[model samples]
Target: MDNLLVKTGSSLKTFFTELGGISIMVFKAFAAIRIRHNFIPQIIEQFILIGKKSLPLVVVTSAFMGLAIGVQVGFQMTGFTPHWIAGGMILRTILIDLGPITIGLVLSGRISAGIAAELGTMKVTEQVDALRSFAIDPIGYLVTPRLIAAIFSVPALLVFSNSIAILLSYVSCNMTIHITWNEFVQGMRYSFYVSDLMTSLIKSLVFGVVLISLGAYFGLNCQRGAKGVGSATTLAVVWASVSVFVLDYVISTIVFYA
Candidate 1:
């Protein structure tokens, strides 16, 4: 019992310590944005890397998710109800919740893991120290661009994903229940609201910041050697993914209530 209590206390301490570090890193990255003037090119490069390169995966996953939701909604509907309502359901589900959350989780796995591993490798190899020796602020040069790129790219990707998902859902509804494209589109138009769109974008932005900042934090503070790098990469992915869901709930509750 005593051993278990000690372990639990240690784990809690580590969690808070890491959380504090990530928060500090995020603040510093934002501050560094004003001080660092030469990262524009790198930011653009990261935008392409984080946003453009992620399009294929986002589109494919979102399309399939829409199809699945459409089919399921169709199955659950009674014959008396309009089939067109499936379109509204799909649109609402995708845009307001699933779309941003799904994109965040996907990026958390792909981008966060990649950032952690890349930075972790640099840390282990003394490359990060080399940058500092040259009077370069590693956070300004390395972390800032990635952070800015993520903030820009994630919302863009969410928009693309939401559009593709809606399109695919329309197609799926037509095939599944013979709902016409016009009816599906009309249903979507009727149900759509500007506020919902804004909410999704906000969620995407927050999730982007959370994942990228955590990735950089873990990578920068990674312990020595290959094992440490591996651990950081794994933790980065896990924590980023979990944070997306947690933030989703918190944001959604506040949005709905407020």
Candidate 2:
């Protein structure tokens, strides 16, 4: 019983410690932007890497997601439910929930893992120390640009994902339930809310910040050699994914319920 209590206390300590570290890193990342000129090129590079390179995967994933949602919604529409409502349901689902959630989870895996691995490798190799030795602030040179790029690129990706998903959803609705384009558009127009769009964009921005901050924290604080890098990468992906869902719920609650 004593051992169990001690373990629980230790776990709580570690959790809060890590949380504090991540919070500090996020602050420093934003503050580091004052040195933006030094890292402007890196920002652009990361933008392309995070946004342009991720486009193909987003397209494919959004297409399938839309089709799946459309088909499922259509199937559920028995007799009482209006066929036109399917369009609004699909659009709302994609924009308000699925769109940002999907992008957040997907990019958390790819982006967070990659950032952790890259930075962990540098740490293990003492490259981060080398930056210090050269009087370069690693946070400024490394974390800030990635943070900036993610903030911009994530929303961009979400927009693209939402667009593609909605389009494919329309197509699927047409094929599966025979919803005409005009009917789909009308349904969407009626159900559309500016708040929903704002929620999506806010979620995307927060998700981006969360992913990069977690990734950088784990990577910078990595244990040791190759094994440490791998572990950090895994933790980054896991934590980033979990954080996305948590934040999504919190944001939704505050926006819609409150």
Candidate 3:
């Protein structure tokens, strides 16, 4: 019992410490962005990196997941006359939960690792050293644009995902069963409150910051050579996903009682 208590206490302490580090990373990222606005090429490159590169995967995942959600909900509502209550249900789930969450997760999995690996390689290869040697402020040049791009790109992905998910789900509803578009959309509008949509957007922003920060932190701080870079890349995605869920719970709880 004593050992278990000690272990639990140690876990809590580590958790808090990590949380504090994450917060510091976010603050530094914003500061870097402020200092690095002159680098238009870097900023645009990040837009392509974070937004364009991720679009295909985001679109694909949103469509299939939306269809799956429609199917499951349709199965559950089969006893109903129209059997098309599922469309609205799918829309609600996608808009309020899965759309943002899915995009956030995919961003973390793909872009977070990319950022970590890139920065980690730079760190190990002395490119970062060169920047520091030139007094270029490595964080301003390296972390800032990526962070800003993430803030913009994650939401862009979410907005696109939401539209795709809704469209695909609507297609599934009409194709599988036969519901009027007006009725289906009406049900969706009624079921999905604007407030929930706002909640989802807020979650996406938080997720964006968390994932980017985790990647930057792990990458910038990595030790050793190629092996350490690889390890940091893996850890960045893992920790980003974990932090997403943890932050999701906190957001949900606050929204619930607010």
lDDT of 3 by residue, 1-258 (tens): 999999999999987886787677777767766643478678789988889999999999999987877666655665555544565677767866788778878888888898899899999998989999999977778878877777787887888888888887777776666666887877776687777788788888888777878888888888889999989999899998887777877887898786
Best by TM-score: 2
lDDT of 2: 0.91
Candidate 3's C-alpha runs over 4 A off are: 1-14, 35-37, 81-84
The root-mean-square deviation over C-alpha atoms between each candidate and the true structure, in angstroms, is 1.4, 1.1, 2.1
Which is superior by TM-score, 1 or 3? 1
Candidate 3 overall lDDT versus native: 0.80
* lDDT of each residue in 1-258, candidate 2, tens digit only: 999999999999999999999998889888878754657889999999889998998889988999899888888877787777888888889888999999998898889999999999999999999999999989988899999999999999999999999999888878887889998898999899999999999999999999988989999999899999999999999999999999999999999999
Candidate 1: 10-residue stretch with minimal lDDT: 31-40
From the highest TM-score down, the ranking of the candidates is 2, 1, 3
**lDDT scores for all predictions?**
0.89, 0.91, 0.80
Let me know the TM-score candidate 1 reaches against the reference structure: 0.96
* lDDT tens digits by residue: candidate 1, 193-252: 888898899999999888888888889888999999999999999999899999999998
Q: How far is candidate 2 from the true structure (C-alpha RMSD, Å)?
A: 1.1
Candidate that would win on lDDT: 2
lDDT of 1 at 69: 79
Per-model TM-score versus the true fold: 0.96, 0.97, 0.91
